[model samples]
Target chain A: MAVVCFMVTMGLYFAATISFLAYLLRRSEALSKVSLGITAAGFVAHTVALVARMVGSSAAAPPSVHEALSFFSWMLILVFLAVEFRHRIHVLGSFIVPLALVSLISAAALPDTVPTLQPMFRTLWLHVTLSMLGTVGFAVAFVAGVMYLIQDRLLKSKRFNVLYSKLPALDFLDDLNQQSIILGFPLLTLGIITGAISAEFAKGAYVSWNPEQTWALVTWLFYFVVLLGRLTVGWRAKRAAYLTVIGFAGVILTLIGVVLKSYGTVS
Target chain B: MHVIVVGLSHKTAPVEIREKLAVPGSRMGEALTRLTSYSGVKEGVLLSTCNRVEVYSVVDDIEQGYGRIQEFLADTHLSLSSEQLTPHLYWHADDRAITHLFRVAASLDSMIVGESQILGQLKDAFESALSHKTTGLIMNKVVKKAISVAKRVRTETKIAEMAVSVSYAAVELAKKIFSDLGQRTVLLVGAGEMAKLAAQHLIAQGVGQVRITTRTPQHAVDLAEKFGGTAVPFEQYKDDMASADIVLVSTGASHYLISADDVQRAVTVRMNRPMFLIDISVPRNIDPAVRHVDNAFLFDIDDLKQRVEKNRAERLQEADKAEQLVVEEVGVLREWMKSLEVTPTIVALKQRADEIKRSELDKTLGRLAHLPAQDRELIEGLAASIVNKMIHGTMVTLKSEVNSSNGAAFVESARRFFSLEAAPPQDTRGESAVDSSSCLAHDMNAPLVEQVPSRTASRKQP
Candidate 1:
């Protein structure tokens, strides 16, 4: 049942991506509504699937790459929907929903083993989940940054229809970038702290200095500096938007390092 | 009845030619009266808008109806000779006319496809025809169905959702930038006509405050009074830009009035808040480099015009989708019309059955002349009930089949199999005869139902 629901969630996400893309071309309110509804439905299915997986898998098993990726995409959509409803930027889905699909597709490409979660009854799972959500926040900022660049280009180039009309305002995308970073930074701080404490619990050392651990700290510092710049001097979205890409790079590297480590242990 | 449409639209004739042949609203009743006065026309409607002038009518003969409507068109617009008018007028008859009406109502045939103005115009024209009493059962059904088809197109296709006009495009862009125009302030620079129209549009969108500035102080002051706002001196407009969220510049001056440095300084004064600059002047009053300024978006007239062009292209694509919907609805209306044609046949078949039953009952009764009165009454009831039950089944099946795809074929076969056309439903051996038997042959101009409406009110002495 868990596996079936997981596939169903993937299918719903695919449909949502297509609908959002279609809405971009047509620019109709009805299509936007339908696209949002589909995304909401997909989010529901994702939650159900995750709950079913938790119910099915044994508690002692550690987190697999598949489960981590699934939760990451799920958290991204959760934040995306909250922002969408608050702002009513229908076009935002065109920029964000496809990223969810890409994440889900990556997860699907991995093995179908039900990832029960981490460290049995230990707090290490908290560490994994928090860090994953922190990465999701950065991913949201990255998507917003990408949109800002595209809108900025379209405005500067004087292309005033289709994609230009369908995109959110430059200022709105900029504000969103700042807001997501502001939200994500604290979670990332706590996420790193929890990871350090859990490292001490699991391997009897506070600092493991492993590839994933090093990458996570580096990514955290990068976003910390970014948040400081935005808070202190009130930097524009374009600069922060361009800078978020480096933080996103750190996220990708950390995920890769963890997945490789998990494969070495599981196989 | 045959439905015919004769008209000219923006596609066929230039506005100059259309204006010469146009009929205004005040003359609609008189024009419709003259239209139905023609020998072939039985019911009529005249639609006159700036883009097109058309006449929709039900007629006895398609060819002669077109000729008669053409004659009426010629009579109304004597300034334009037949040589000039004949080249522009288009005529459609029967099902094609219905399809044409649907397309027009749905705005597929408009100067700007997917515009909603045509639908309102069509409804107004239809209402005029309704009030003038120029419409009967067929015209009413066709026009009403056309209106519904237009509505269906609007809901089923995203044709009219986007703005295709330049002024409307500006508002759409503003909404994209600001999300809410209610708190935004607009600074109007120069008083060009088109720029003022756009400013009025922005004001209508509930922009917070409007400030007008022009080279002439009196014109600025008067325009400010008209717009319910204050006017600033032309030299002091730059200071006003700091508080303004939107600035519209249109002047005949060859040099750029608002330069990149000015916009840069304004953004600083507003603490980097976004400013929307629109330049509609010929030489362009705002500097193009203002777009490079942080949070400043500048659009010239050509940019808005380009946006309008792109929006028009998008609407045309949606128009294709709307056209498909219209075609589907036309099929539905055509099926309904075929069923309407079957009503008369259904009535005729029942009448023939009744005549046969009565005649045979008379023969049997004459043979049993010495039978008891009670037994004769019993026999009469039995024969009437049996015939009624049989005809009821056949009529129900016939009515049900008339709306199907091959309904016309079944109706034709039923007419032939029952020999309904060869023998009219009147009893030849009886004293009473229906003098309206001429209506039995399915005359296109004749009433489909049994009751012929008194159309005398529709045709006056004029």
Candidate 2:
């Protein structure tokens, strides 16, 4: 049942991506609304699949790359839909939905060899979820940042092309980028604290030089600077946008490393 | 007879010439009456707008009508003579005139295509003519048709949706910076006209408060009062920048009024809140280096113009589609006008038949002068019956075609197929034929029908 739901969701995401890309060219409001409807439908199917996978596994095995990646993308779409509902910026769909699709496709392409859940990993589930959710927030910021820089350059260079016309205004994108980090940073701090507690329980130490732990700390510290700078110095626009992009990259690389390490152990 | 338009538009005339020639709304009735008073002009409507001043008229002769319109223009303006105005005026006749009017109504020929203002102005011009009673049947149908064409263009295409002016472009850019202008504060640095217009547009969009500041404090207070806004002392204007979301700097100062350091300080004071600065003056009042400020977005005149140009290009592309709609509507009007000519054509045809039958009967009766009067009457009756029978099928076919979709094709072919046009305008043969055939007296003015067309044409009421 879970596999069927995943397949259905995969197909919907693919359809939504194509619909959104076509809408970008037409710039018709109806088409964008319809495209958004399709994405919402896909999000429903994806959520069902996520619940089914988690309940079915019952925390018996370490999560497979497919499940982890699927969960990450699910969180990403959740954040995206929230932003989309609030902003009503149709152009963001063209930039953001493709990220979810790539992650889902990557999950589907993986071999079904990695264990689905970890022993005692059930206790750390909340920690893992929060961290992934934090990454979702950063992912949103990345898209917003990329859009902000592109829109800024387009404005400055005075090349008001089709792409430039559709993107949200630079200041709005900057605001979104800052807001995403502001929301995500605290969740990550909580995630790090919970992770430290789990490490203490499993390894009898609060700090383990595990690759995942080390990278998470480094990413948390980087975003810490971003949030601090944002609050005190009013770090925003170009600098905030660039930092969000770099910070999200750190989140992504850390995830890739964790996934590879798990696969290396299995092989 | 033809529909002719003679006027100066933005493309043909400078603003100075257009302003001199434009008729004020208060005197539109007088201008229209004076326009139709000319010998060649049958009916007239004067469209006067900031960008163009045009006279749309139905006339007896396009060439004579164009000249008379120039005279009317010279007479109305008084400051500009026919010789001076002639170089700036453009004239279009017949089908081209209708097409031009349609394009104008659609706003395809506007300085900025798809602007929407021209359509309303055209409607007003038509209404003014309507109230003045200067418009006839042709002008009424044509002007109303032009209005409907504009409505169709607006509905069928996305032409008018693009905001293409420099002022509108500024609004678009502001939307990019701020989510809504309704609650944002606008600070006008100087009393520049374009800046005032832009700030006024923002206020119309519901911008909360306006603060006007200039080097001349009295001028600032007076201009500020005009906007119902507060006037700031020039030295204290920078303090207002902290609360102001938008800053419009359009001073003629040789040096930068707001430096990069000033922008940085304002952004810092506002706790890094975003500020949108629009510098519309030639010598930029806002510092160029302000672009480096983190929370400050500055756009000068050139940047705004580039956006306007891009939007204009898109509007022009959409206008290509609007032009096709106008052309399609013109073809429809052309067909309707052709149907109008059917009555005159039928009259001319019967008149020709009478001219032939009467002259031939005269020749035959002279030869049979020795015969009895009763026999002569029978021969004349026979000729009349034959002539009626020959024209019966043609009259029925031509009359039925007036409502058909391809009625124009039939009208053209019928005119060429028959010798209706064979009789010249001064055909004296028509008068003698009229004298003999009293029953066909109404139709006997065949040569006159060539000049005075349709029932309404001779009456002059329409």
Candidate 3:
């Protein structure tokens, strides 16, 4: 039953991706509405699968690496849909949904392990979920940043195409990038602080610098400087958009390292 | 039974000749009356605009109708003779005339392919003819169908979506940058004519506020007052750029009026908000390097013109789609006209068959007059059913054959075979053939044959 539920979730995400692809090829009001509807359904199915997994786990333990990956994918979709609805950024779905599909597929292909519940893992789950949410926000900002550069290049070159006609203006994309960063930086800071506290409680040595923690701190500092530059020196538009794209890369690398380490510990 | 058009437009006639033939709005009633007064002319509409003057008439004979209309036009301008005007005029008969009118209404034949003015002008001409009572059943149907077809072409095709003028092009570019202009501000510098025109277009597009600045403060105030906007002093205009989403620069100064430093300062104040600067002046009021700023987009006169030309090309491509739609509609209208011509012959054949059935039934009943009442009722029912069965095949054949090429000749032969009296088809119908408004009404709703009137049998109102 769990396998069936997970397969359904993957299938829904794939269907939504196809709709978004059609909307990208030929811009139409009907097709855009359908894409949004399919994405919303896929998001609901993902939530159900994640909840089922958590309930079936031994002693209601926190999610393992595979389960957590699935949950992270779900969080990414939820944040993207929230921003899409609030800004009416219909074109952004064309870029965001395919990334969500990739994450879900990876989650489905990886093997799951039912690790014993550790006493300190509950506190660790809180920091892990918060970190996942922060990375989700940065992923959205990364997509917006890429769109900004493409639009900027198209306008600067004076080459008009179908995609150029459909994409939002550079200003809108840049603003969205900044807003996502502003939303993500604080969550990441809280996530890192809670992570250190949990590590101290579990191992009695929170000050030891692990590679993942070092990378997370570096990623957080990058965004912090970016936000500061934006506030103090008006460093936005192309410059800020590029930095957000780079910062998101740092966040993703750090997440992969953490997920792989957790998987190794389970094995 | 034929649609005829005879007139001169921008294509064939010089402005002097067209102006001479044009009937102004004040004289439209007189022109329409004269048009319908021509020999063999049944219904008429006069369309007179600055670019073209045309008379569309539903007439009996195309040859006589064209000659009469040409003479009428020459007489309107007494300085010219029919021969002198004939060289500049072009005439279309039947199917060609229908196609021409549809193309005109759809704006395919316009000087600018997708211009919207011609449609409105055509509508006004139709309403004028309608109000003058010079149009009857056929003209009414044709005009309404033309309007509906034009509307379809507009919605189904993108012929009118592109901007062809420089002022409109600026607004189009602005919309691409800003989705909603309702809360955006526009600042006009120099108060020049081009700037004023662009500002007006921006206002018409629903920009929030318009501020004008000029070398002479009074001129700025006067221009701003005309558009219901505020005027800023020339010295303070640089500072005002911080609040503006779009700036139209058209100063007469030879030097660059807005430098990169000025724009950088404005960006700092606005926290890098996007600003669109349009330089319509030949001397280039805004420095081109200002475009290098973070959120500044600058367009010069040449750039706007190029964009306009590109859009015009796209409109031409879209016009091809609109023309195809017009061709299809014309074919449908041609089929409808053919059905109108065959209606009279069909009605005559049915009437003749019914007369024979009634006479035969009377004779049979008289011969069986001594029969029982039940036997008499049985004979009447059987005879009526036989008559209906005989007429059904003939009615179906006639209706289907009306769409064929040799339909009129076929209809004529059928009339003669039934020993029916032959009359001119156009004169058979009241007012005009093709009172298709009734047919349209029937098709639009419940399919009740009771509402289908024998319009061809009625006489023309005296």
Candidate 4:
């Protein structure tokens, strides 16, 4: 039953991703609405499956890397759906749904060997949740940044085609990107701070110079520069969009590094 | 039917000619009634604007309607011969008339291409005819399609982007230069009609100051006071031009009023600041050579018209997409019209077949009065099956014929051949049951339950 539920959730997630991509390519509003509907259903199913697995294991926390990864992916999808519902930005799903599907598929393929919860694992869970929330924010910002660049280019070239016609205004896209960054950057800072505190709480002594921690700090600094540049230099729309794309790239690298380090240490 | 459009426009005739033929709004209804009642005319719609007064109509005889409409116009107001009116009057047959209406509604045929006001005017004329019931089926379809086409063009094209008139062009140029024109100053020279119009545009753009000048100081003061600007003498016009960022010159002189030297001095006095000068006069008031001076941007009438032409071209490109949508919608409406023609014939044919079954059953019942109830029921079911088999081929043929071009005539023929003119009593029970079920479905959270399973069961059992 657990495996069936997991497979169903993953299938719905992948189907939603494909539909969202179709909506972007074809620009069919009907397809976008359907994609959002599918994503909502998949989110509900995924939540049920996660709870079922936790209950089946009878564990206070996630027992394995697969479970932890699944939890993180589920959290990302939930955050994405919540934002989509609140903001009503159907285009963001074109980027986010695919990422969620990839995460789910990867989590499903990983070995499910349960790892004993060391005292530090609880601290690790907190770190994972915060970083995941921060990454979701970055993902949304990246979508807005891409739209802003495309819209700005079209407007500059004076070629107002249907694709450009369908997009939000240049000013709106720019503001959306800035607002996402503003909300995300502080959450990211708090996430990194809480992560350090967790590390200190678990190890009795601070662990320093880890590549994941170093890269995370670097990602934070990149966004901090972006926020500062926006505040001080009166950064133009295109420039801010480019910075967002660069900052998000740093974020992805940090996430990969963190995942790889955890896998290496666990094995 | 022959369609003739007569009257004058800004192209062939002046406003004085058009205004003489223009029917006032109060007299429009009486005009339409008179036009429809005229000899050889079947339907009529009159379009009267400041530029043109054209009567569009379908007539029984082409030359006769032409002569009647010409005589009617001659008798009403304009005492002109057919020879005089014939040159300006354009006569169109079937397809030309349709295309003319389409172009007029789309604003392509207007004096100003893509001007949206003409479309609204056309719609008002159409609705007036509709209210008076003067339009026939052909005009109804044509007017509705034209309105839809106009709407599609407006949405799909950028044709209505910038102002086309020279006065509006001057305003638009200022807007492009300064996104917010609330602080700009405008200087008007000569206080001519063109200059006054330019001042209106400047004030609309939120100009901070409007300064006017003329050879006659009283005229300049009167115009300045009207538009909330200060008046200055013609001798100080160059000085006022230095203070103004936008200057409109429309003087009545045959020679250049503002020489290149005058603008050159103003450019220096203004510290090489950019100035927009619009000269909307035939005997150009600003020197043609002044355009070469640094920071002095000059636009004559021809230059402004050229920009308007470019904007019109861009709008035409967008109209192509909109035209495709209109064509698609028209095709859909045509299909619905065809289907509507087939419906009544099919219903009547079914009723005829059912009536024959009921009469035969009544005759059989009289003969089988002595038979048992079970045997009588068996015989009745067998008779109904035979009747169904007999009409099945004809029903299939009717359904196939509906998809053809002559489908309406074919259905009419079928109804006559089958003696099925009278409609059968409608069964309200089944319809009421369906309506109630739909209401129940609406009240509930789920969709209307699919009847496929029950339908399949009935098919298999039968």
Candidate 5:
């Protein structure tokens, strides 16, 4: 049932992505509406499947890394849908659905192995959930940043392409990017703090110089600089967007480092 | 309905002409009343703005409406002749007018594309007309739909998101240098309209202070009072220029208002802190070479206009999305209209046929009273089947022909051929006869007489 639900959700995500692209090309409102509807339905189905798996499992918490990742991706979709509902930002779906699809596919392809829940690893769940949520928030910010940069470039270069035409304006995108960063940065800070605490609890150390931890700290520092630049130097929209993209790169590096380290340890 | 638009805009008319043609706020009610009273006009709305004055109206006779409007303008203004104004007047008919109104309401046709002022202007015009009851059903529907389309374009597409205006562009540029304008100070030179507009925008962005300087102290004082700022002496303008973060100069002076030397002095005094200077004057108030100064940015009218033009082009491109939306909506509306046209005729035809069946069944039953009950029921079923087969082809023809251009004529012909007028007007209060008949066909086991018209003469005698 879990596998079937994952497949169905992946299919829905693919359909939603195609429909969104169709809306971009053909500029059809009906297609846009249908795309949003399908994505919402997929989120619901994926949620039900996750709950079913949780109930069937004998584990006290999430069974494995793969299951945790799948749940995290589902949470991202739920958050995205809620935002879209409140803001009525149909264009964001163009960015979000593809990311959701990638995450879903990755979750499904990962090996299904039940890991023993060590007391320390149990504490790490909070760290993982917080970091994942923060990363998702940053992903949304990155999308907004990319849109701002493209719009800025178009305005500067005086070439208005179809994609440029479809995007929100530079100021609105700038505000959206700033808001996303403001919301995500705190969550990320908490994630790092909790991870440090969890590492101390598990290994009797307050801080570890692991590459994942180091990169996470570096990512946090990047956002800190962005906030300072925004406050002191009054960093303009384009510069801020560039900084967001760089920060997102740090996030990606941290995720990869953590995954590779986990794999190495298990082997 | 024929549509005609006659007026001048910023492109075709000078400020003098535009101002003269502008309908003052006090005169709007009277203007709307007079416009609707003109001959051949079915409905009318007048859009009067500082940049443009246009009258949008539907009429039975386009030429007559156009002439009357021209004459009305001549009579109101008293000095301008119809011939003199005719060159500036533009006329669009039918689809062209509809497309023009939609584009204008969407701000795609504005001097600055995607400028939101036009939407408000259109709403004001609609409301004014509504107050006077000058707008008819056609204009009401068209204008309401146009407003919805404008909103959809703004929300669904990215047309209205950016700074397409020069004043707004200046503020956006300021944001690029300083993320937050709340701590910055803005200085206005010469109290020009453009400068005032830029000052208003800066204030809205949370600029901490505003100072206005003009060659005429009273003018500067007036502008300062309006924007809740302070007026400074014109001679002290150079001294204050160093203290200000952003300076906007739009004066009518032929000579440069802020020379390169003036900026160099200010830059040195301010310790090379970044300063933005915008010169919107026609002849260029600030020296273009000042842009060469280290950390001192000077943008002339041309540069700002170029950016605005780029934004306008981008907005136009985005308009394709809005256009696609409009096309789809229009298609749906046209389909609904066609369906409404066909329904009434189908109902009338079905009622007439049902009445004929009931009368014939009654006469046959009277003659067959001596037959057994089961055999009578069998004969009645056969009669009903024959009636259904006979009407099937006619029904098909009616449904097919009802939505054609000559649909009304076809319906008229069918009504006459069937003598449907004598059928006691079958329950026009209920659903259409076609729908009722389909429901009847689906439930064939039910009594057929319930679906048929009762005898009209028996009801009249009672």
Candidate 6:
């Protein structure tokens, strides 16, 4: 049931991608709605697959790497649907669906190992979930930033093609980028605080500031400066978009580094 | 009844010739009446707009109808002789005439295809023709079907969705740049006519605020009042740039008015929020270098014109789909028209048969004058029954062949064989015989049951 659900979710995302691409090529409003419907269906199937995985588990263990990746992709889709609803930027699906598809496919390829929960962070599932949400938010911001730059380049070059017509306005994309940052920063801050508290309550546990941890701090501070600069120095548009991309890159690199660093302990 | 269309549009005539032939608004009733007064014309409609002048009519004979309408065209515009005007006027007969009328009503033949103005113009023309009492059964059906077909074209195709005018194109582009224009400020830097038109379009789109600034302060005040906006001093316009989302510059300046450095300053002040700068002046009021400024997009009149051209091309592509839809609808209408061919033949044959029966019965009664009145009545009844039976077989044959491709030829052959040419066709002109509602009811009661309309049967009012 779980495998079938995963395949169906993947198929829907692929269909949504084609629909969105067709809209971009034709600048069709009807195709945009079709793409939105397909993506929403894929989101539902993805949510069902996640629930099935949880129900299939024994409940006493922590999520494995593959499960965490699956949950992260689900978070991304959930955030995308919310942004799509609020902004009505159906064309953004053409850019974001491939990312969701790749992450889900990667998760599906990984072995479904049921590992015992770590003693120190067994009760810290809330922190992990919050951090996933934060990263998902940042990923959304990354997509918006990329879209802004493309639109900005097209406008500057004065090449009004189908892609240029399909993209949202520069101002709207910039605003969406700001919104994602606003939603992600506080969630990341709370997740970090909760993780620290959980580590402190565990006996003989010391929260070490490893290189990956330090990198995560730098990513948080980078977004902090971006938000602060937007408020004080009025940094926006191209500069803001570039800074958002850098911040998201920081988050991804830190995540990969931490996962690899802890690979030896997973067994 | 035969349908005929005679007209010249933008395609066939230049503006000078079109203007000469255009019937004035006050003279429309006169024109329609004069058209129907012509020989062989039973019902007529005159459609005269700035783009085209056309006459639609139901007539007794197609050849004589075309000749009369062409003479009327020559007479309406005395400046042009019949010899010169013949090349400009086009005539369509029968089903082709109805198809032409539908295309015009649907705006396919318009200078700008898919425009909504032509539909209203057609309705106005129809209203004038109806009030003049020159439209009869055939024209009534033609007008209603044209209107419904126009509505269908609008709903089924994307031809009418894109903007073809420059001002409308500017508004569409602004909407693309800012998802909601209701919160964006528009700064008009000049009070030119084009600028006023663009401002009106923006206002129609429900923009937040419009500020006008011009060298002529009074003109600025007047334009502001016209659009219900605020007037700002020309010098202070630069100060309002930071607050404005769109800047329209169309001053008749010989040199560039707004420079790149000025736009850069505005961008800095507005926190790099995206700005659209439109320069619609001949000499170009805003410097083209302003496009290089971060978050500042500048478009001149040429760019907007190019956008309009591209949009027009897109609409043209959509018109291909609209034309296909029209072809399908015309085919349906043609089938309905073809079925009416059998009606006239049926009426003629029955009239001829009854006349023969009456003449022979009268002769027989005269020769047997000594016979009683009851014997004469029985002889007359027997004659009528034989006529009815003979016509019934012919009516059944005609009805069965109505759907065949050669059904019309068969009807004509039958009419010739029965010597029905001497009999006149039923004349229901200048009456509310085929009013659309009753026509639909008649269609519901037809032999084909939902396919062909019973036009001839229901086309007799009271």
Model 2 chain B: weakest 10-residue lDDT segment is B432-441
Model 1, residue B330: displacement in angstroms? 42
- Share of reference contacts found in each model: 0.30, 0.53, 0.33, 0.00, 0.00, 0.75
- What count of clashes does model 4 give? 1
Could you give candidate 4's per-residue lDDT for residues A25-138 as a string of tens digits? Answer: 685789888998899888888888988877787545534657766776787677667767876767768777887887788777776654422336455565656666677677
Scored on chain A only, each candidate's TM-score is 0.92, 0.92, 0.91, 0.85, 0.91, 0.90
| Candidate 5 residue pairs in backbone clash | none
* Candidates arranged by TM-score, highest first: 2, 6, 3, 1, 5, 4
Candidate 6, residue B156: Cα displacement in angstroms equals 25
Models 1 onward score TM values of 0.53, 0.58, 0.57, 0.42, 0.47, 0.57
**Ranked by DockQ, top first:** 6, 2, 3, 1, 5, 4
lDDT of each: 0.75, 0.76, 0.74, 0.65, 0.69, 0.75
* lDDT (10s digit) by residue, model 1, range B1-462: 578999998789876677667776557789988887777687887877656889999886799888999889988888887778889999998889989999998878864456565665665666668877777656776777777777777778776564236567677667666766888888888765446767888988898888988766776787799888779888899988998988888664546788999998888777566778888665567988897886788888778767777556666677788888878877776665554467888887888888988899999999999999999999999998898887777678777875443344466567777777632111122211111111110111222111222233332211
Instruction: Count steric clashes of candidate 3.
Output: 0
* Tens-digit per-residue lDDT, B124-183, candidate 4: 566567666667644555566666666666656665443235567677656533434666
True lDDT of residue B420, candidate 5: 55
TM-score of chain B of 3: 0.54
On a 0 to 1 TM-score scale, where does candidate 5 land against the true structure?
Answer: 0.47
Residue-wise lDDT of candidate 5 within B1-462, one digit each (tens)?
A: 455677677667765566567775557789888887776776788887656778888676778878877777776676777777778777775556766778787777765556565776676677777777777545665677677777767778887654337787777667654545877778988654456667888898899889888766676776689888888898899999998888988664545768889998987676545577888664567988886665467776566666566556666678788777767654443332333344565776676667777788889989999999998888878877787777667677767864343343455456567665422111111211111110011111322111222212221100
Place model 5 in a CAPRI quality band: incorrect
Candidate 2: docking tier: acceptable
Error of 1 at B38 (Å): 57
| Most accurate candidate by lDDT | 2
DockQ of each: 0.22, 0.32, 0.24, 0.01, 0.02, 0.47
lDDT of 2 by residue, B305-412 (tens): 677764566666777888999998888777656544668778877887888899999999999999999999999999988998998787788788644433434555
Off by more than 4 A, model 4: A56-72, A112-121, A204-207, B1-112, B115-462
RMSD of each: 19.0, 15.4, 17.1, 24.4, 23.2, 15.5
* lDDT, residue A263, candidate 5: 62
| Clashes (N, CA, C under 3 Å) per candidate | 0, 7, 0, 1, 0, 0
